[model samples]
Target: MDKRILVELTTEIVSAHASVNEMSREELLDEIQDVFRKLNALVGVEG
Candidate 1:
């Protein structure tokens, strides 16, 4: 919900994978889930 978080996440996702056109939906979902987990840990994984 935070703008900074959104931007950081988008930047990470885009930088890692370039274009969504090149990644399958499930593959992208997996990458997103991984990034979210890492970000959550950085925030102390509280909620």
Candidate 2:
């Protein structure tokens, strides 16, 4: 992935984690997993 895009994704993940403190543990895990899948696709990684 391009550096800029990677940085943007990182920022997005951080923001999501920081802002969704009220979410249940399961929901937060799902959200993090979704972000990882997206980042993997962006980097051409099969997951």
Candidate 3:
């Protein structure tokens, strides 16, 4: 998997979720990781 795609997708997810502004740094990282995990599962890509 390309790193750019992951970054782009994560960025889009973060940008689309307004609640991120209220999250702590750890929470935001968890949210981003969750999104990547789900996306990878859907696309049959290993982490």
Candidate 4:
């Protein structure tokens, strides 16, 4: 993966988490998992 793409993805993830309000634990966990999956894909990791 490109360094720029990784940096952008990390920034987006941080922004998304910071923007959330009043979310349940499960919902937050799911969002984190989704972000991880996206990052993995960006790095060419097989599912």
Candidate 5:
């Protein structure tokens, strides 16, 4: 999968969750990181 698609998907995931509740700066970053982590795992990305 392309990195851009991963990024867009991650953004969508985070945005969907964030839309339900207001997140602090740290929480937002954590959400983004967590989504990327899961995405990377699925893609076999070692990062």
Candidate 6:
């Protein structure tokens, strides 16, 4: 996987979390898990 893509995706997830005001702890955790899943899938892709 490209390091740039991983970094950008992480930045996006962080930005999205920072923008959410009403999310509960569990919701935030779930969101993070989702992000990991997405990153894993992207890493699995062959260029």
Candidate that scores best on lDDT? 5
Cα lDDT tens digits for candidate 4, 1-47: 66566657866885677586666778777766677667877685432
> Which one wins by TM-score: 2 or 3?
3
> What are the lDDT figures for the candidates, one per model?
0.65, 0.67, 0.75, 0.67, 0.89, 0.70
What TM-score would each prediction reach against the true structure?
0.51, 0.50, 0.66, 0.50, 0.84, 0.52
* TM-score between candidate 4 and the true structure: 0.50
True lDDT of residue 6, candidate 1:
51
lDDT of 6 by residue, 1-47 (tens): 76566657876885677696677778777776677668867675345
TM-score of 5: 0.84
How close to the true structure is residue 42 of candidate 3, measured as C-alpha lDDT? 68
Decide which is better by lDDT, 3 or 4. Answer: 3
Better of 3 and 5 by lDDT: 5
**Candidate 1, 1-47: lDDT as tens digits:** 55467548856775667563577778677777677767666664323
Candidate 2 residue lDDT tens string, 1-47:
56566557866885677695777778767766677667767685422
Q: What tens digits encode model 3's per-residue C-alpha lDDT throughout 1-47?
A: 76568768877988678454788788888888888878776665434
RMSD of each: 4.1, 4.6, 2.8, 4.5, 2.1, 3.7
lDDT of 5 by residue, 1-47 (tens): 77777889999999999999999999999999999889977995432
Better of 1 and 5 by TM-score: 5
Worst ten-residue run, lDDT, model 5? 38-47
Per-residue lDDT value at 20 in model 1: 37
- In lDDT terms, how accurate is model 4? 0.67
lDDT of 5 at 34: 93
